[model samples]
Target: MSYELQALIGPAELVAVAAAEVPAARPRLLAQGLALIPATPEFLAAFRVGDEATAAPAAAVSPSGTAASAGFDWFPGGLERRLAAWSKAGPIACVEADYFGGTGTQRAAVWADGRLDLGPITSAELEPFPPEGSPISRALRRLGARVTEGDDAVRDEFDAVGLGAHRATVSWVSAG
Candidate 1:
């Protein structure tokens, strides 16, 4: 199976703030009781109201009580400011992954306390299981995803969080 996703993951309350601001935002649930708000195409269009150059929509997830928001302009001035504002509550991660038949690229960045805490880290398509501290792994760790003992199949924070449950951002919307 292939996977394609772009999202912001952070605290549930902070994510709710993002959802409330968007027009027609829908919430879904992921494994481990995480909340997900898929940034449907409509919502992305609304989020880009003032900034036409925005690349994606905004989404968030939390650690204790996770939340996922799919599709955000991962790195744009306006969105960065907004993410900084949201980070006042806690860390927020912008993660993008696209794997065609289990081989593709992944990258992520994190904001916390109004600052860029982690990456802008990128992983090559050939390195599916990036070593510790890789972009997505670090970002997921920042968001509180953890590896359990003796789970050989679940290698990193990404697997720990069960993000592969959905194939795309639109799937999240349809599931909602």
Candidate 2:
């Protein structure tokens, strides 16, 4: 009944997250301003450009003209980033991820299908990135989600990385 967390390091095209370890610190990643999938290595690398994401929220890669033209909202309240990040590791979106019986814990494998089929990588070198922030909280606020209720904080921590805390109360399935 233990769940480990991990973060995929790659781009939307293809992603390979870091090794799954006993998650230590969970930092919320914001990608609204950036408009890129937070799951990709490129995006994570972009975030690596600086460690500010550790101190605050981090913006995801900005959606290109194509993704925008495709009617994709750059900031699906951070849903895109969350989806990409979770999918890379092969799990269901926590938001979409279900909690059974409304109590206890559940063990299962889940896979996520990120929304919006964005587009090819652009050479438009993302703007000079900035300090990071809590993308999860921001997205939650944007979506007007009641994250404060129940195990929302645990889910938020898990979304920041790839696994929820040990005390997340709610049940979560593994995306094996």
Candidate 3:
């Protein structure tokens, strides 16, 4: 009985699991979050989004139980709210020298029965382009940032590069 978790990365990309077959939502959501972080900025920002936009958006997992688009922006405001919701929660506090769109804000989402949701992401919208050669990564590369992927279990070292800096590693545990 596993459910998919769709995490919003940057403004455009959505690291989503379209009905992955996991045993529980917590590990699956957390794993999906780490797995979905765009290794590069272009991946960070891909696809277009419309805030206040509405449609029957599926929560990342497709009807066929597969990752719906390498990312899912299937609904309107679908992408923006995801990012905004997480930011607003304050549980996922993010403070960085550089962030996408030059700034960020936060709010809250409702969760129940082992499912979590946040949205109508406060003015949260997609970046409108792919995150290729983004300002943040390009700078980090110049500073010789030792980047790697996997090992998402270690919170403090799996952060992504955005805005003007790399995340100072994260240590997160789901309340679920």
Candidate 4:
């Protein structure tokens, strides 16, 4: 199987703010009480502020106000400034992962309290995992996703948060 995702994870209120900026944001609830808004093609088209595909995706707001927006391009200009503004209310994590044919790459960055907190971390195939773990894992931790410690069957932050339920970003749109 192969998996690829690009997303922003953060407080539900903040994520909702991000979503509202877009024209047709669809928010969905996932396991672990997290909310997700996949960056479907339609969503991306509606979200663009100008030419050059400046917008990323919509957002999902959890009951607890923890949310995520998937299928984003982090390198676009002004995204960081927007995320920083949203982080004033809470922390936000930008996460990306691509895995296929036994090789993969992951990247993540976090904004909190109006500034960049952790990463723009990147890890790729054949490289050792970072001491803190993969980029997504680290970003999830910053977003309050927890792991089961001292257990025979250990689950990392990503698994604990149930992000694996969808193998692809597009799957999230039709997911129940």
Backbone atom clashes (below 3 Å) for every candidate: 14, 23, 14, 2
lDDT of each: 0.66, 0.29, 0.27, 0.67
- Model 1 error, position 95 (Å): 0.8
Instruction: Rank candidates by lDDT, best first.
Output: 4, 1, 2, 3
Prediction 2 TM-score vs. true: 0.20
TM-score of each: 0.76, 0.20, 0.21, 0.76
Candidate 2 Cα misplacement greater than 4 A, ranges: 1-19, 25-50, 57-83, 95-111, 114-176
Residue-pair clash count for candidate 3: 14
- Alpha-carbon deviation at 173 in model 4, angstroms: 1.3
Give the distance in Å from residue 13's predicted Cα in candidate 4 to where it truly belongs: 3.4
lDDT of 2 by residue, 1-176 (tens): 43322222222222223222112212232222111122322333433334443223222343343232222222222333444555553333222111333322211112245443322112112322123213233322332223334755444432443334322312121221
For candidate 3, the lDDT comes to 0.27
Q: What is the C-alpha lDDT profile of model 1 across 45-160, one tens digit per residue?
A: 55456765444333332112112232223433345657778788878777787889768887787888987787667788787554575677788788777789998988777777
lDDT: which candidate is best? 4
Better of 3 and 4 by TM-score: 4
